[model samples]
Target: MMKYILGIAALLFFSCGNKEDILLPKADRTIVKEVMDLSPIYIFFRVNGKDTLAEVNRKNSISTTNWILNIDKRLPLRLVIPEVMKLQEKRRGDSAHKNEAAQNYYSYADSIGKNLAFIPFTNVHYKMVKPKAEVIVFFDKSNKIWVNGLMIKNDKFKNFINEFIDKKSENYQFCFSEDLSFGNYIQYEIYLQSLKINNGQEFIN
Candidate 1:
């Protein structure tokens, strides 16, 4: 009778441990699409202070007529091209903006990495750190970072590192600062959503 009781207790303990592990929170892989106004969408590209609608279509393989019509149909497509292009141009104008931010993160990570080099820390993954001490967090973009399993802003961290494929190498410094934190031991995460699309295919540039 004593042996049977001990066996049952061991089994129960193992079962509970497995249950806890299974219940651990994980990031969702769903892409939340934001709504935008569908109207006279100005479909034009500029090169050398000239409207290059034809050139944009030729270079980007984006058909303005088809794109406009598809918008009219309310298809499930994100207008990531023109928006991304505009972002690229802006980044080019401010060359040091990205490098400066990246450098700051790397500097901080070097300090921390050296100190905690031997200590094994779980659930903390560093993505990018600049020499200037600007750190980019991976897991912060997901809903898992919040206590309630909902997405919340971390104002403490000076930046949130978002990953997007750049085919043109337009936005090499892909990370951006979402929030600011002025302390050591920053906590965050990265959430991988749906497969990234480039030119209507899963391609990362």
Candidate 2:
């Protein structure tokens, strides 16, 4: 009887230990936890597969059109684009049933991509650092860039920006025109990210 009790106690201890292992925090848990805690509706992407947008829709818990799509860095662009397009398609379809003003807004947002339509409730994923000396970077619809209210040619951006960095500019803010394409906006964002800024910080407005 004594041996049997000891065996049972050991099994229970191991079982609890296994459960604790599963609850341990991971490196990427910060963003995941933040999104889960703040977002009313969110879809998580995984290596093997992902949670379907259809599944989320079917649940009827999503009251808003916006949903957080949490994707892994390793996920292929080909796999992700189709899903994103589906969301865009749904947004377009939703606009059809709305009033004329709402429809127009949707069209406008699609044309330039809405920058402020939705925002993260928490700043856990990224930091918002105030710049010491604000240097404004504006992008027009024609892919033209303006630095500190001065127009600079597309090819001359590197040279123009280097001057600012040389001046020890610590703060950078990016602004987009209403008619700018989403692709152009993303391209510039990538380009700016590769630059060696003093504080390595930029904000979109």
User: All candidates: CA RMSD in angstroms?
Assistant: 24.4, 17.1
lDDT of 2 by residue, 1-205 (tens): 0010111101111222331110111121121122221112222233335432221221322323334433322223334334445554554556445322221101001113211122221111112232234677777667778877799888888887787655354466555554443334444544554564424333333
Candidate 2 structure, TM-score to reference: 0.34
The Cα local distance difference test for each model comes to 0.21, 0.36
Clashing pairs in 2: none
> Could you give candidate 1's per-residue lDDT for residues 29-55 as a string of tens digits?
212121122111122222356322211
Name model 2 segments beyond 4 Å from true: 1-134, 166-169, 198-205
Error of 1 at 156 (Å): 41
The Cα error of candidate 2 at residue 101, in Å, is 40
Q: What is the Å distance of residue 71 in model 1 from its true position?
A: 15
Q: What is the RMSD of candidate 1?
A: 24.4
Q: 119 in model 1: Cα distance from truth in Å? A: 27
Error of 1 at 142 (Å): 25
Highest TM-score among the candidates is held by which one?
2
Per-candidate TM-scores read 0.16, 0.34
